[model samples]
Target: MQLDDALHAAFRREATGLEGIDVAVYEKYDRDPCEPIIGLGPREAPIGFFGRDPGEQEVRWGEPFIGAGGQKVREGLYRAIHGAALPDFEASREVGRLAFWANTVPYKPLGNKAWPMAVKRRFQPLMAAVLVDHWQGRELITLGREAFLWFGINQSRETRQALDAFWKRDDRFETHHDTPLQLENGHAATFRLYPLPHPSPLNQTWYRRFPDLLAARLESLDAARRLG
Candidate 1:
């Protein structure tokens, strides 16, 4: 009946087919295999962030977007809401609670590779429930190309085409656009999406500027007014 119940069921059906999963990564972090590794952080949070998937840090912390790249986004949010530096990673989880979070693939993959399209398609419906039925926010800051494009999954053909066209725009990352989504549960809503380059330290092109870009994205939401 609950979203977690649905996610676990789906994971159970697909677990055997989920290839390239680094089970060692989960074991290294002492993560429970039976526990579903996805969901919104705090209900009705003002901001929501969708990422490509979990990494070592996320598996260890048992929270999406709690890794290095996630920390960058959180620092920007902390600065926007409190006008002060977050001080340390010790507060990263609490800072992350300021918003809702999810990912394309809830679990990590081997060698940090993104999930294949078939896998994404298989889980798209469940992720849709997380966004449409669980998250109360009307907007999301999508990190990376995969995360932004995941919105097109399980949507109407028109919406898929529209999201693709929007991604082609040169200004896609600099501006926010509204996209409609429909879930199997009959939930339908349009969420404004602000795309941002993934903040992974290896992404030399945008890594350094990620914080500044995230600040602009939050300002676009008037995040200060709605949060902390």
Candidate 2:
């Protein structure tokens, strides 16, 4: 089988095994739980955003990060560019110009709950292929603690501590960033992982702070690209 076909088959196998995702619920919403939301842009964009999973909006739209939180992200990008919202700003294949968007788990759960550990484990290999083998991304902005931890960042105590600090937003640990991530396929590469709090309104504190934080990250990425 071709690589894409193999990946799709893998996704279908895992989705069939997921106890958390209700097939009827997906049908009710007119979404296909087995369909992965890979970004619409070039696979090899230098910057990437990794979210936990696709939400209902994303599943319906066949895109990752298209709900309220995604709207904030798009706005943040425009803010980085024009310092204000564009009258007609919208995310599209063009957004890939700056970065590509993806998720740790490509499938949507029933009610936006975290995926079962079994599901995450089952799909890690495929997700690694999407990020490392297909996209070859350099800088990754992980949208939540889980998304940050998704990149095989838990081998040593020191690494776990760094992930914890990132989760807690410890200022003293701010200076230290990025991890030399090795995916399951043995694709070793350095990825700058900016762990940000999930931008959901449920996360009230970070919800307000997400815009500026995202803008800064985008600006830093732009600067780096220019320098390179």
Candidate 3:
């Protein structure tokens, strides 16, 4: 089967088994009038980006990151890879070519609210499947704290310690970017995680610096891809 079709079928099968308050919400927002926001890019892509969840724009467009924050990410990636600025709201085909993009929560929330633990737990396995099984991604660039924190919560105690050190701005993360983690599906893998502040305009503290950080990470990812 084609990769995208296979993934959709897998997601639908998983959806059938979900049960909870969020199930109703997931069903309501993930079908018919709304479309499930699946990840974009080739399965072989070495770099993947994770975001918290989709907004209305993403739900409507059937893409992961098309909102304002996404624009910043795409712009930065384009600058890093091609050394030029990308036009705002360029189509997904253009922006998504740089790397794979997914979200911690596949379904868009009603008001773009944070997904409850119930929702996160339910979809964690599927998220792992997409990133590890389907994409085989080696590096993950997480957009916000909540996105990467989920990994720490479900990972080993040793990994949790490393995450804490990274949180405290330890230099160890810089020297050894890769960390071993166990996905919700019991898949063991080593991933280089580039945790960055959200590119939302509301996050004024890192708003200006986000582009530089993203560009640097993209360059690093490019180097790694070449080496591999």
Local accuracy of candidate 3 as per-residue lDDT tens digits, 50-136: 889887666556677777888888777666655666755664347576578888877666556787887787677667766666776
Query: What's the best-to-worst order under TM-score?
Result: 1, 2, 3
Clash total of candidate 3: 0
Q: Give the root-mean-square deviation of each candidate in angstroms.
A: 2.0, 3.4, 4.1
lDDT for model 1, please: 0.81
In angstroms, give how far residue 68 of model 2 lies from its true place.
Answer: 0.8
Q: Write the per-residue lDDT of candidate 1 for residues 1-228, one digit (tens) a residue.
A: 135666668765765556767788889978864345664766788688888988888888888777778888888888998899988887767777767888987878888899899889887887787777777887899998899889888778988888889889998889987998888778788899999999999999988888888999988888888877
Per-model TM-score versus the true fold: 0.92, 0.83, 0.80
Expressed as tens digits, the lDDT of each residue in 1-228 for candidate 2 is 124777778777877756777566568678776677666355656667888987777766677777778767766765665555645535332443456787878877777898866778778777776666677567777787788877654244766676666667665113326666556556766677866779999998778888777777777678334312
Highest TM-score model number: 1
Question: Native-vs-model 3 lDDT?
Answer: 0.68
Worst 10 residues of 1 by lDDT: 32-41
Residue 82, candidate 2: C-alpha displacement in angstroms: 4.5
Off by over 4 Å in 1: 1-4
| Model 3 spans > 4 angstroms off | 1-10, 13-35, 91-93, 170-176, 183-186, 223-228
Instruction: Estimate every model's Cα lDDT from 0 to 1.
Output: 0.81, 0.68, 0.68
